[model samples]
Target: MRKLQFPVIFALFCGMVACNGKSGNDSTPSSEENIKKEEVKIRKPVDQAGYDVLLQYIANDDTTGLWPVPDQPLPLEGAVLPYNRIVAYYGNLYSKNMGVLGEYPPDEVWRRLDKEVEAWKAADPNTPVLPAIHYIAVVAQGNAMKDGKWRFRMPAHQIDSALAIAKMRKALVFLDVQVGLSTVEEEIPQLEKYLLMPHVHLGIDPEFSMKDGTPPGKKIGTYDAKEINFCSEYLAELVRKNNLPPKILVIHRFTKGMLTNYKDIRLRPEVQIVINMDGFGRPELKYSTYERFIRPKPVQFTGFKLFYKNDVKQFPHHMLAPEELMKLRPRPVYIQYQ
Candidate 1:
């Protein structure tokens, strides 16, 4: 782990500024049908000379730091992560009970999210913190729809709203899909347009991906490695075809049953996989769950989710600190506050 030099920092800042400029209008289309008609201009890869300079600086620098370096092992040797640390706000814009993301208006949400990001930055100054919006693009429902999917597909307007927020913050966006009674094959391709955006990523929640046609929230659902692999392959292909940087694919899990056949999930340079610990409980209970369910499984990267209300209800004292979470075997690169 090492801190990025001033030159590297400047390069990244310039790249981000350019990216923001390219992100045209913030206004969303009027309807979901029209959203498909609006084409997304593919992003070009980072300047090779600048990327090479940053890599050379990282390789030459020997300063130790409290956080891992972004792209430490290099893309050639299994490293695909773009940020040293990621802090995200998770939930849909419609439901406050779901998470903090929806608990406040857009301005307030950004304010709260920035507070968390600042905390992480202060805790680990060496690592660059990437702000993120983990939008619940598709929500599982108790009732079965006409298609019997038992899920509510978020309209493109909602997705665009999240993207607009992310653009304002110059942060990354993740569209989370809960495929109740539906297959990943059916859900993922629907978000292909958003996934093509440079800063937008993807997340699949196994806890709601009921393979048995059961309604969500009644019983824990499951996703096989085959399903996870499909997402990775799809994202990888997107990276290749668009000549963009690697895409991150987040998989939400808190129990063994949430993700089946984990051993068979494939990893590629074009796609970074994050096995996110998504359960909320007492601090000890949550840590134990992470150790048992997430620690044992070696994934490309790791993520942890914290519920602002649920976690505090059980703990009654305090939330897990960044230092405490960093003590895990493989430190989580992505953290979400729900």
Candidate 2:
């Protein structure tokens, strides 16, 4: 969970962030086979299937036919997008207000997560719902306390705890980052030990990436395509070096300024990119935010975020049901709850 007062903006693997410290292939040989099948579908000259999925995401209304993301590189085997939906619970262990992942004890968290996963499974029966834990590895701060980065890194033990929790159900783990005044180039490598594992993916939050020395939470931040490409290229190198499945890169947004030059963000077979719309508000407001920021822009995959508290804090205060979200244009393949 993250700051939502801005109320606008938008941003993997389904199960590849699998338990047992492996890619999706650890015990599921079939997943590789499925990727071969996906390859065939992905390589069609016209890419009609990809276009069709885009239509479904947008409720089949791409009259202009602009957004079936042309020439997307066929993902490496064990990739998780465009086939399965990843249902992730996001937060930091140090703050319950961050998200559901740390809001309760691990048992209660899993219980709630299981129920949510089931709902997604039933709502979009065609796309398998894979559970995941999206933990905040780098947290933004209100003040530039030390070195003026205005960010804090979680200790190794806490990240270990997240991995341990994900292993409980063979779930995926995504280490999210809020760079604050820091740069992705500077912050991401610190987590290389965990990221080297097959199941651990990456998320970079632009909302907290301040370039002008402003502290996070006071004002929103931004990331250009150049910076994002750095992350993609970095992950691609890891995937190639480790010979692991494709890595997922999640970018969070609710406003247009949070992400810029999206057209310049490169796509790679070694990585699956998800642009998740993570603002907290009523259904209509959230839907508008998605439409304003996520729908028109072309990305490899799309995601929707729901806020348990902020979404339901006011009038017509209720979270968007899984059933309702399925109706979104270019239907979201990723769902996050905070």
Model 1 Cα lDDT, one tens digit per residue, 1-338:
23658778878886675555543434533344365454343333445454445443322232333123343333422233543678999999999888887888889989998988998888767668989999999899989989988989899998999898888789999999999998889989999999998788999999998877678998999989999999999998988787667788999999999988887888776777888999888789889988788767765567888877778785455678787776665667789999
Residue pairs clashing, model 1: none
Residues 35-120 of candidate 2 have per-residue lDDT tens digits of: 78766643212245664464455444555454556677777767777667899999999998799877798999999999999999
What TM-scores do the predictions have?
A: 0.77, 0.83
RMSD of each: 15.9, 16.6
Estimate candidate 2's RMSD in Å. 16.6
- Which candidate number maximizes lDDT? 2
